[model samples]
Each structure stands twice: as C-alpha cells, then as structure tokens.
Target chain A: MSGADTVVWMVQNAGSEAGSREVRVCGPALGPDLRLARLDEERLGPYSPGIYAEALSALIAGERGEERERRTIVLLPHTYQVAEFAPLLAVQLGAAYIPSICGAGREAEGGGLRFRRAILQAKLQAEVRPRARTVVATLQSGAFGSDEPPASPTRVVDVCLPADMERSHERQILGREAAGAGGVDLAGAERIVTAGRGVGGADQVSVAADLASALGAELGASRPVVDNGWLPREHQVGSSGHTVAPSLYVALGVSGSIQHLMGMSGSRVIVAINKDPEAPIFSVAHYGIVGDLHEVAPALTRLLNERAARRRS
Target chain B: MLPRRQTGEWGLRIGVCIKQVPDTDAHPRIADSGRHVDDRDVNWVISSCDLCALEEALLLIEAAEQAGGGRPELVAFSLGPARVEEALRKALALGADRAVHLLDDGFQGGDALADGRALAAALRREECDLVIAGAQSDDLGQAATPAVLAQVLGRPYAWLVMAVDLEREHRSVRVLRELEAGMNEVLRLELPAVLAVQAGINKPRFASLRGTLQARRKPLERMDSSSLGLDPESVGKAGAGIETTAIRLPPTGGGGLLIDNASPEAAAAELIAHLEREALL
Candidate 1:
C-alpha cells in the first residue's frame, strides 16, 4: 500500500450554527486534522464551481515547504460537482488530473504509484501514472468504502477563503429540481431484472419482463433501453436514474456502463446473460451465461413457471 | 430564407469542438506497445455526444434568428491528424458556417491538458463568443479536456448540460444540468462561457444533399503550433501530466462461475439446479 505521512480533511459548512455541528461529527472520524472552510449561502450562495476551484486551489497550495516535496495526492468524491471543477483545480495547480479512478497500486517496474481507471464506457481498464509530482483524482463512489479512523491524532490547521474572493459572476445558480415525477421506487426491491440495449426493440423487452415476473423480481431498465423509449424513465437504473442494491440482480443483455454498474454492483447476488462474452457486466457477475437472451430468457421463464405449478399442487 | 449573419461584426459566434473517435461498436485491440488501443484499420466517426453538442449549437443559432436577434455564426473546431478534416467537412455539411482544423505532428499523443492548451490557443485567436463540446469522448472517456480548455480560456464551465436557452439580448444562457438519480440543477452563465453537453440533449439532424454540396465550397482553415504562438514542448506528449503505463481487460470477479451456451432447455435446467442449491430460487 502507498502510505501518506500526513492527511487533511477539508469540511464545508454553510452557517456558524451548523459549523460547530460539523466539527463535532467529523472531528472523531477525521481525527484532529480537519480544516473547516465556511461557504455560507448568504456569502457564496448555492455551490459554485468558480468558488470551489478557487477555495481548494488555495488550500492545497498552502502546504509547507518541507511537506510539499513528498508529493501531494488530492482525492475527491466522484460526484457531479467535483467532476465539474476538479479538472479546473488541477490545471490551476499544474497537477495531474485523473477522474473516475477505481483502484491504486505500486507499479512493478519502477515501484511508482499507479492508478486504475475505467475507459471506453467501462469496457476496458487503464493503469495511469502521474508525470507530475502533484496529482488530482476523483474516486468513483462505492469503489472504496469508509476507512477506519487513525489511531493517532495529527496536527490541524484551518484555511480561510479571502473575504474579497470573487464570486461566480459569469455563472449563476437558479435552483435544483427533480429530473422526473416519482417513478417506480426500486429501492426496496428484493430482486431486480434490468433490461439493456441488447434486449433489442420495444417488442422484445417482454423477454426480460416475463422473466422478471416469473422470478418475482422488479423490472428495471438500463439508460439506453429507457432512452430508446422501450421502458419508461422511472424504470431506469443508473447514476442519472436510480441506484438500487437489491438482494438479487439479473442483468439481461446489459453491457454495464460505469454509471450503471456503480448503482447496482452492490447487489448481493448478480447474474448476467449476454451474447457478448467480453461484456463488462460479466466482470461483476456471480454467475454468467454467454448466450442470446431471446433463447435463454424464455427457457428460464418456462422453468420457473413449471416449478411454481408443482409447488402449488 | 434564413437571415444572413456577417462574419466580422454585430453577430454572435459560437465555436463547437468536435472529436473523431473509433466507433464504439468496434472491439478495441491493445496495440503492441500496450500503451493505447490499436487505431489501424478501425472505423472512425464523430463521437455521439459531440454530435449532440454540435446539434445544440445549431439549434441555438436558429432560435436566435427566429427571435429577431442577430443571425449567429456557428464555427466548428477539431484537432487531430489529417483524417480529422473529414469530421470538419461533415460538421459543415451539418450546418456550420465555417471550420477550423488544429493539425500538427507535434499535437499527437497528447493528454487532456496538452490537447486543451492547443485548443484554447486556437479558440483565443477566433475570439469566439461561446464554446461547447461533448462531456466525454467515446474512446478514452476521460471527460477532462473541455474543463481544462475552459480553465485555460478563463471562462465559466458547465458539464452534463441537458437544456440551453439563450436570453433575448444574447448576453447569457439558462441551462439545466443533469445530476445523480434523475436530479437537475438550473444555472445561468454569461456569454463567452463554455458548456460540455451530455448525450440525449437533442436528436442531431442529418445533412441534406444541398447542404452537403454547399459544404464543399466552405472555407476550411488549417493551423499549426507557430501560428497559434504556442511552445511546441508545452502542447503534446512533452506536456502530458499523466502517462498510461498499460491498458488491459479488467480482472474478472471472485471466481465467478461461467456457464457455456448450450441448448436453451439444458442451460435453463443447469441454472435452476444451481439457484435451488443456493436457496436463491
């Protein structure tokens, strides 16, 4: 493992009242090394990419001379906001920027630190090494669960933003709104069967839907299936749609984009059926069948129905 | 007839960056060096998301014209080897007023930062009122160049944009940005900002025969490193911040069982027995 001698956690709080609560909550887990930065809505308004890039660039640059030579790795959660401004921050600091990173290790050749990132819509993986001393990377959510707090408390320093730091005059935040009306709530589902683009046309979606019905599973749809109008927007399962972690997840004809996999990879048991053996979905599946869904799905549905009939008699 | 907009003054100019990528349908074979995908004999096309960005630019210009605003000029920009001109010509056929190509041997093998620097230099020369591009490329899928370009150009940037509405005076634009789990945030950016459009924003229109014919006469300009006043060392492989040590297939899951295809009945029977043994059926 690549170990860091020093670690710093920057916490963002809106108002003075909530500021104390954050310190109380984050102090224990993050230990003594917590830096609080105030971004009250009254002063900065809703989250602005301009303010974030400026604030973070300053904080990261403020490291002492002795600490700077060891190399700095700035890790951000791969959320929508971080995805927007992290690259800009990297440019401002002249550091390497690698987004959607899933893993890290030391390379065998030079023993240099390397990061793993998904490419080609998660169909392939690339091991990237930073050419610069400072690196900025966004870790894909769920890729790394919460870590245990440190045994020893470290030094802490608070970094404040300039009182006259410019606001985002070029961009203004209007408001946030839900993408669609409350669609099918799949959060509580025990089992889910998600149909993907390889499921073919709207008429062919029944192959997966029937299997879902026979297995007593909720019907889910990948982004492309929903985008093609084969399924409604509510049934969509992905980062931009719904994040579900059911007990069982059976992906039918799904190629498994990164966003889609992030949402459902936490399921207890995963089964993938697709004609393409190289499909990324198989990488995460507990059981996989390489075959046409049209043939495999109907056969499974028939077997389930026969078993149900026998149980009833 | 569409209201004509002059090139130099009193008209808004929107620059769209387009990238040609290997078709997603083609399986990428790792090259011998193991640093990147093998580009030989691969079919290339304009990335789907970038096509949406171009379509959005054309729509905004048309809307401005219909609202009695000045006819907006749409200029398409692309940076790549000689084959990139094909993508630029296609952009012209799709309704762009002009096209600019940033081509040079020095620009090859660049990371996002290097590529963005070269693009920002060319865009500065054009004095574009606005810039737009796809949120991510279909090949590398890095999704960083646009943001880097925006930072280098010192402009406000918005990613995963779903909707765009320009103000009547053409001073600012209102856009909706896509967030996780079907959430959206509405934002307004002043003119001269950059936007990274997401897929599914709008359906791109196909080129008409007349449009294709007229595109042949459209002026296509080529630019090199010296012309853009950029140091060659700071704009390509020499300036890259990250190095790809290797590209390989992802490791499979924890000893996952792989069942080969057989007769549908036989496969289904095997699956049922396995599920039953695990008490999952």
Candidate 2:
C-alpha cells in the first residue's frame, strides 16, 4: 500500500480523560483517513478477552473490501488488554500483532511500514517489519508526543456488544475495589517519583514522598519496596505492577532493574538520583545525580519549595 | 461448551501453563544473525510471572483442602524443546501433582498464536476445571498465549488476574484483574475458564527437599505434534503469523548529564536549573 490503506483506532474508555488522550495521540502517526472505533466501556461492561475477540472479529469481517492485500492498523489502549485481544484480532484480519510499540513510520527502504519497540526488558530496541497485509499494535503510553494536530473529521463507529455475549454466562463482572491508601495512580500522573530498595529504611520513604509532594508527582515504588511492606501493592511499578508513561519520572535510589525499566521506559524525561554511579537507571536518565537519596531527596524538595515561594512572591 | 461442575473426589482440577525462559537478569547477547538473542550461554528458569501462576494454583489447592473439600489435582503444562522438561519438573517440585510436557522439533519458533493453538490442543486432553498461566512470558513478553489458548479452546478468559476465588458450590470463579492506575475489576468466570495471572499475586514457594524428591517420581507425560493431531502447517515457523525482520539495539538516549556540585543543596539547585532549561520543572 502507498500509505496506510485504512487505520482503525480501537478507543476504550479507560475511566480517565488521559486514556482518551493517549489513544488520540497515535492519530498523527496513523496518517489521515482514520476510522475511530470507540469500544464503549459502558456497553461492553467489564473485559472478557474471548467476548471482545468475537466482537472485534465480527466488526472486521463486516468491513466490505477485498480480503487480501489490505493494510489495516488497529490501535489499542492498555498493553495488558492488547495482549489479550491482539492475537484474536490479528487472526481475524490476517495481520501481525506487535506489542509495546514506541514508534511507527513508513519504511524508507521498503514500501510498507515499520514499528519500533523495546525488547530484552527495555535493554534493546528492535525495528520490526510486519510481512502481513494488516498490522495490529499497542502503543506504549507516552510513546508519541501529545501535540496532535486537529484530526480530520472522521466517523466514530460504535461496536455493539452482541446480545448473545451475555447469554454465555461464562464471564461475569463481580465488582471493583479501590487499590488502597498507598495506591498511586501512576498511569494518570504527569509526574512520578519512584523509590527502590536503595532508599534504605521505611522511614526514608517519607523523604521521597516529600519530594513527590513538592513536585506535584505521584509516589511510586519498585517491587522491593512493596515486597518489603514499605509501600502498598498499588504503589509498585514494574512487570508486576502498573506501567506508567509520565511526562517526568524521577527515580530515587532505584537500581533500574530490567523489569522496573520495562514499566517506565516510555517516560518522556527520566531523572535518576542514586548513590551508586553505575546504576542502570542513569543509562536512560536525562539527568543523573550521584548522592544519597536520604540527603538528595530532602534537598531537592527544599529547592522546589523555594522555587514555588519565589513564584508566589 | 458449558463447564460442568465437579462433584467427585477432587474439588477442582487446575492446569497451570508455564514456560522456561532465559533469566531476565542475565545479560542478553544478540545472536550473530541479529534476529534474536543467543540463549546458549544463558541460564533458563521458569518465567517470573509463571511462578506466580503456579503459586496461585498451589494456594487454590490449599484453600480447597481447608474447605473440607478433597485436595485439588494441579497439573503443570509446558511446550518447548527437551530442555523445557526442567521447568515442568520445577513446577511439579513446587507442588504440582503431575505435569504434561509438549515437546517436538516442529514446536520450535512458534509464535504466540501457534503456541496457544498447540497448548489448547493439549489442554483439551487434560479436561481441567480451570487453567492458569502467567500474564506474559518473559521472552516474547507479548502476554497473548493464554488468551489465545482460551479462544482456541472455546473458553472464557481473564488477563492480569491478581486474585482468584473459587466458589466450588457455584461452579464458578471470581477473579480480580488489575487494570491501569491501580484499578481492579472483579470478574466471575464460569468453571473451566483460563486466567493469565499477574506476578506478585502470591509469593511462590520454593520446593522443599521432600517435594523435589516426590516430583521426580510423579507422572510427567510427554506429547508431541502427532499425539495432539496438529497440522504441520499450523505450527512452528510456518504457523507464526508475525515474521521478525530484524533485531538491533536501540539508540542510546541523550548522554546522561551528571550534576556536580560542592554540596547537596548546590546539587539540588543545579538539577532544578537543568530541569528548567529542559522545561521539565
């Protein structure tokens, strides 16, 4: 295809405005002539991968076009959901499903397109080529700049959840619970300050918390912090925890384990503060400070507070 | 097919799908071909999240036993080369009653979908009450296998499952799925459902010496492509829907600028100035 033959953006209401924004940010990269397929969360109710797959299959099959040599791009919101849906969608549309895509662009050498994603736990980035006619991918949060140009007026198609979907009774939504006090909504936060094991005692976590408060950032934790009971499960960020793509991610005393990096590598700007100079977090950090987080965190908070005072004056 | 309730000696027959993956902490060396990483020198272990899934199954078995119901039979399943038997054995050692190893030369390089199809085929033979797998494998990290297997097997599925509660009396399971921003959705799935469990849902127990000895003697069945009656065209490289064109290291980020100052206060101020210059503060 010369350009993208057709782009289908699967927009899911993630119960947050930022979720919608993240979906829209991929529009520019998808090129014009975008078709917005809004997956109404209210209608779909809770997520069941099987039901969603059937619905998506029906939607794609309903499209009237030549079966072969058609290029389609499907954009998904959450990576976890993407994992659940991509394979089924790819099978339905005869596409290649790529996960954790950070960038996509027309191939300079080849006539088709290419995608860029991190592999080896974010230690390496791979440029991928989809041999299939259709390509399905989930863009990492914060991968694309949010400065999207006014999109071309496009039709939003509402995918109705099939009546038979409820008849199965195989999948049910019991209820939802709050993540708890230490639970930080890292995905929605523009700024995040994360603490790791190197932060020492649980009491020292307050120092990082103070810095986060000064910067108007959410407080996040590596696996060890949560494992050690210094923070709640929801505060944890890594393969096991929430994947956050904030504007600014400040790592305090974190050694930047590969699993932790996998969750936060999409941040626009990363700042690392660690006593050890060889910490891997510095590799991806825009700025680094080699100092004890106990002292550095408090000092940074103080300076930020002073800046705020200066602004007030 | 509607899942039938259990009314026999066992409370629930649970199948846990696990994988042997290169340790995530190991230094990854891109192969000479650059299409994939060289695993020859890397030590392989059970994918981290898979351990959590195994632990979850073990916990469920314990819960069933405590509820006055007979102990549940937990089966660990894996598909890979001969080396993968090690991982299945580890699962057995960790408390699985039995294991099914799907091994064949043709099984190599099967993408997530192909692997799922093969696994689903194997699972049909086991006829378990519930199937659990890691949210995603550490190697591909696509997190698609269990969901695809559920679809192929015609079963309901949930992903990123944080907690699973079995209501044996109701012939159903209630699972808490972790979503974005610390939000969790509680799902009640009928029996015979598949769940891709998240890591840290439970702390995986190390195998006791006694458990390890028992695992060696436990039944570990081996099946291949022919035993499952799978089509040759639908597995391995031929079955892979996505073809990897190239693999190369990502370009390094901006040179990490270390802020040097005489005092902590000075360092903090310098960092703020840098953030200001970058319009980040």
RMSD of each: 4.5, 4.8
lDDT tens readout by residue for model 2, A1-313: 4465555555554344433555566755555656666565676665666666667656665662544454577777645565667676766666677877778777655555777877655655677777655677877665666666435426677777766655468887778776555535787899999988888868889988999999999999997788668888878887457778899999999977555876897788899998876566777788888898888889999989989999999
Which digits, one per residue and each the tens of the lDDT, describe model 2 over residues B1-281? Answer: 22333434755688999998898766678888888888789999999889999999999888888887688888889999989999998898899988999998898878777788899988888888799999877767777788777778777888888899989778888999876545788989888889999876887899999998998998888888999899977887777767666777665545878886658888998888888987987
- Worst 10-residue lDDT window for candidate 1 chain B reads B1-10
Worst ten in a row by lDDT for model 1 chain A: A22-31
Give the whole-model CA lDDT for all candidates, comma-separated.
Answer: 0.81, 0.77
lDDT of 1 at B160: 95
Each candidate's DockQ: 0.71, 0.49
- Tell me the native contact fraction for each prediction: 0.81, 0.66
